[model samples]
Target: MASIAVYSVKGGVGKTTLAVNLAWCAATISRRETLLWDLDPANGSGFLLGVEAKKKRAAQSVFTADEAPEKLIRKTAFDNLSLLPADESIRTLGRQLGSIGKKKRLAKLTETLAKDYDRIIFDCPPVLNELSAQVMRAADLVIVPLPPSPLSARAFETVVEEVKGSGRKHPPILPVLSMLDMRRTLHKQAREANPKWPAIPLASAIEQCAVTQQPVGAIAPRSAGARAFAQLWTAIERKLAAKK
Candidate 1:
């Protein structure tokens, strides 16, 4: 299975939105068995997909080898899609992983899940630490979502360095602009400067993801936000295929 991580050191960039929506597209549209793994303590992926964690701090067990991930993975309402939800217990994961000193432990666990899932989408935490290092080692492609701002550009650069400095061959990164409003001059200029970078326009459908707890694609398939996600998923598929 191919592991795709929707990650960014900067938070509030719609990272979780991209992760959940793309996983939905992969499962519902591409017909791939997808696992949306929530590595963030906030549990955004689980909340968005309407899956609840059965036990507190259960997610960290997988990383610690105390419990098999398969036992903790919960099926979502969507077909061919499942979730390994996270909880507050993950807050100490960086320290725990550092103590273990098995850099590839997460990668090995991902390999074990390959027998079941065709794709694993990680909703990563917004932090610079050992957890990020582990994700860098496991992911095949990294998707970094940025907004139309100078800070976002710097965050993009930091993400690039973080991925490359993982002490291994780095994964390819695709930077996407999120919450873009073409009416704004800043957004327009950002888009013009990097025409190749996919942008998700500001839309109510996407914002409602928190309230509706469903991907924009599942709620409004023809909406601009949904279309953007579909197109992005296509690009991700191409990147993974080329890697193979």
Candidate 2:
């Protein structure tokens, strides 16, 4: 199974949205048994899928021998898609990872789940802590969403530098230009500068996913936002194929 992480050093770049929609695409479009693992403390991924995390135990239990991670897996309304929801308890994940002292704990966990899933997407929190390190170690591909801004560009550079400094087997990083507003001159310039980068336009339909509590593809399959996500997923598939 291939593990993909939607991560960013900076927040509010639509990381969770990408993770949710991509997971949906993988499941519905590609017909893969996909798992969306929400590592963000806010649990936005779960919220989007209309699944609340039934946290019967602490977050650490997922990594411990006491509880099997499968026990926490919750089926979503969509077929071939399941969600491993996150809770507020995940805020302490960095500390817990540090205490475990296992550099590839997350990797190992994903490996165990590989038997059941064709694709596992991690909706990671925006932090450069031990948890992020573990995520890098685990992921086959890291998808970074950058909004059209100079600061976002700088943040992407920081993420690249941090990944290089991690000194682990590096995963292929796909930088996507998200929340693109073509009307903005700067956004147009940014897109023109990086013609190869996939972009998700800033559309009301994309934002409405939160209110609809569904992926854009499911809510409005023919909408621009949904098409953008589909194209992004197609690009991701090509990248993964080329890697193999």
Candidate 3:
């Protein structure tokens, strides 16, 4: 199974939204048994899936023998999709990871889950610490969502450096332009600069994900937002295949 991490060094870049939507694309469009693993404390991924983790402190326990992730993992209403939700307890994950003194602990856990899943998407927190380090080691491909802004370039570079410095052979990074609105000059210019990069437009359908508790594709399959995610997933699949 391939593990994909949707991460950013800056917050409010739509990392969780990307993770959830891509997970839906993988499961519903690609027909892959996908797991959306929320490593962020906010648990936005679960909220988007219309599920919430009951054990408030159990999220951090999955890294050790203290908790079994299989028990915590809950199936979503969408077919072929499941969620390993996060809670506020994950905020201390960096400290817990450092104390354990085991590098690649997250990677080991992902390996165990590989037997049951075709795709594992991590909704990583927007931080540059041990938790992010562990995610870098675990992820096969790191997807960075960059909202159209001048500061986005710096954030993208920061993520590149983090992933590169994570391990000897780090996972490849894919930068995606999120919340893009071509009608705006800045957004149009940003797209022009990164013409090859996949772009998810700023649409009511995408924003309605929170209100509807469903992916854009599931709710409005004909919408541009849904098409963008589907195309991006297809591109990701091709990238994975090429790597193999």
Candidate 4:
């Protein structure tokens, strides 16, 4: 199974949104057995999937014992898609990881679930802490979401540097521009400015995660956001296919 982590050095760049939509697209459209692992403390991906994991069982349980992640793997409302929802307790995952001698604990944990899944998508947090390091080591491909802002560009570069310096078997980093509103003058300028940028157009449907409580592709298959997600998924698929 191929593991992909959607991450960023900065927050609010639509990392969780990309994780949710891409996993949904892979499962529903590509017919792949996919698992979305929510590693963010905010648990926004869980909220989008209509699962309440805030006060309940935390992702911390997974590290405490061998069965926590297995038990936490909950099937979503969508077919061929499953979720390892995040609990606020995951905020302490960095501390927990530091206590263990296993440098690749996350990678080993994913191995046990490999047989049951075809693709594992991690909705990673936005820092370079121990937890992020573990996720980076576990991922076969790292998908970094960036905004159109100059600051986002810098943050993207920082993530690239961190991955390069990690000393682990790093994966290919795919950078995507998220939440791009082409209607804005700055957005238009950014696009024209970076002519070779691999971007998906921004749309309101992408933000409907809060209201619809579902991934964009599932709720509005014909929406512009859904079409862009489909195209992004195709590109990702091509990359993975070429690697094989």
lDDT of 4 by residue, 4-99 (tens): 999898988888889999999889988889999998888888888897653375688787674557677888899999988887788878888888
Off by over 4 Å in 2: none
Model 2 CA lDDT for position 144:
94
Q: CA lDDT, every prediction?
A: 0.93, 0.91, 0.93, 0.84
User: In terms of TM-score, how similar is model 2 to the real structure?
Assistant: 0.97
- For candidate 1, write residues 1-244 as lDDT tens digits: 8999999999999999999999999999999999999999999999998899978778889888889999989999999999999999999999899998998888999999999999999999999999999999999999999999999999999999999998668999999999999999999999999999988989999998999999999899999999999999999999999999
**Candidate 3: deviation at residue 99, Å?**
1.4
Q: What tens-digit string does per-residue lDDT give for candidate 2 at 42-156?
A: 8899899999866743556787556788988999999999999888777888988798887788899999999999999999999989999989888888999999999999999
Local error of candidate 1 at residue 123 (angstroms): 0.4
Model 4 C-alpha lDDT versus the unseen true structure: 0.84
Worst 10 residues of 3 by lDDT: 52-61
Per-residue accuracy of model 3 over 11-130 as CA lDDT, tens digit each: 998888899999999999999999999999999999998998867779988987788789899999999999999988889889888988988899999999999999999999999889
Q: For each candidate, what TM-score against the reference?
A: 0.98, 0.97, 0.98, 0.94
Considering only N, C-alpha and C atoms within 3 Å, which residue pairs clash in candidate 3? none
Query: Which pairs clash inside model 1?
Result: none
Query: What clash count does candidate 1 reach?
Result: 0
